[model samples]
Target: MAKTTKTGRPISLDSVKANQVIELLKSGHYMQTALEVAGMPRSTVYAWMNGTRAQNSRKIQDFVDTIKKANAEAEQALVQVVRTAALGYTVERVKQKFVNQQNEQGEWVPVMVEQEIIRETKRDWQAAMTILERRWPDRWGRRPPTINHEENEVTSEDLPEDFL
Candidate 1:
């Protein structure tokens, strides 16, 4: 296919497919996959969204909305994962399998074996904090302390007297 020219919009792009891409994006799919569904390249999408093409292009708002929606959904999911893990989770499972047993006839026979497994999970505090910082910056972010210097400009005379 020919590259998108002055408009920076792929010739293959269509509203139905573009909406599908947005849905996929909102579902937390990668950009490459979303672009594929949209039948466009990343460059073309960005150009259309960021106004490299027409400022008032209908695609711009739709693209922006798609990105924002996707980001919000992803962030929400991340926050939920972290929160759920922090709250602590437990899993209990039962597994059944067949094991080979030596029969009285000196032939192997299948025997059913049962096993129970229990697991407990917790979120990584540091990693969860990182996600929280990214998702809810104002609430969970830890900002580096700012150091304010008293001196605005230092002249030669402001240097230590001992140096002179």
Candidate 2:
């Protein structure tokens, strides 16, 4: 399998369409001719021919389940190779580029990392809320203030960024 530049994700090209191209190649068609016949992109066809495109976990799991269920040893072995390649992503070289500066009290704080994560989570939550609101406007829309509402009870602005 081929590897991606980021995360070194395994790339798989064992789709039904690729199989058809492979069949054409095995039947004496030139690889280039086969790929052209398949109408697939050059990069995609090259990846398929080289067996390098199966980097997705869901696809790996599907392959494993399929071969195991069918009890096909050869196919199972191929699936195992795909699974192994897909799982071969290395994080060892992922150096911690972040260096936390010490405060006056000499305590190193992860302020930036924490803030970025919080911001990203908040953005994701807001996007989810927007989707939910679009899906069910009446259910999520603002309601009229009740006469018996508690004075101490917080309104929407009191909620956290992500929660709101």
Candidate 3:
């Protein structure tokens, strides 16, 4: 027998579906999209996380913990990517090529070989500026210039000659 929610909807506590959702979440998919891709209802997952449903089994609790861990991992990965963008980094690109080679059986065979190419990404000035401004707003953020209202007050005497 399967567990049902208060609304009589079957709670899909399938580990495979949960793992699929976790993987999707780790890949930066939003909760709704992940649930949809995993063939699970958004309400079911949210209810498991919120413990709003009557099904308070150990499986549900474990599923909730797994979801939280997956979310944290995704967030950490995103933060690392942002930090890397703020500070330039290098990446390795791999390419595979097929070449004809003589095999031990005295026959020509196609062999696949991998070639790695290193690439350097330049730091993004905008990303760096944004990080600096947000992290140290008092020093790097833009602020409106201070004006002395009493000294800069305008009067009718200062009007242009074209004005009556």
Clashes of each: 0, 8, 0
Distance from true location, Cα of 22 in model 2, Å: 2.0
Model 3 lDDT tens row, 48-160: 77778855678888878888888899988877777888799876676777899999999999898866676767677777887788789999998999999999997889899
- Candidate number with the higher lDDT (1 or 2): 1
The collision pairs in model 3 are none
* Candidate 2 vs 3: which has more lDDT: 3
Candidate 1, residues 36-114, lDDT tens digits: the string is: 8777678767766666655465556766677777868976886777777766667666666889999999999989886
Q: What are the per-model C-alpha RMSD values against the true structure?
A: 10.8, 21.1, 10.1
Per-prediction TM-score: 0.47, 0.24, 0.58
Over all chains combined, what TM-score does candidate 1 have? 0.47
Local distance difference test values of all predictions, in order: 0.72, 0.54, 0.82
Clashes by residue pair, model 1: none
Q: Which prediction has more favorable TM-score, 1 or 3?
A: 3
Query: Cα lDDT of model 2 overall?
Result: 0.54
lDDT of 2 at 14: 58
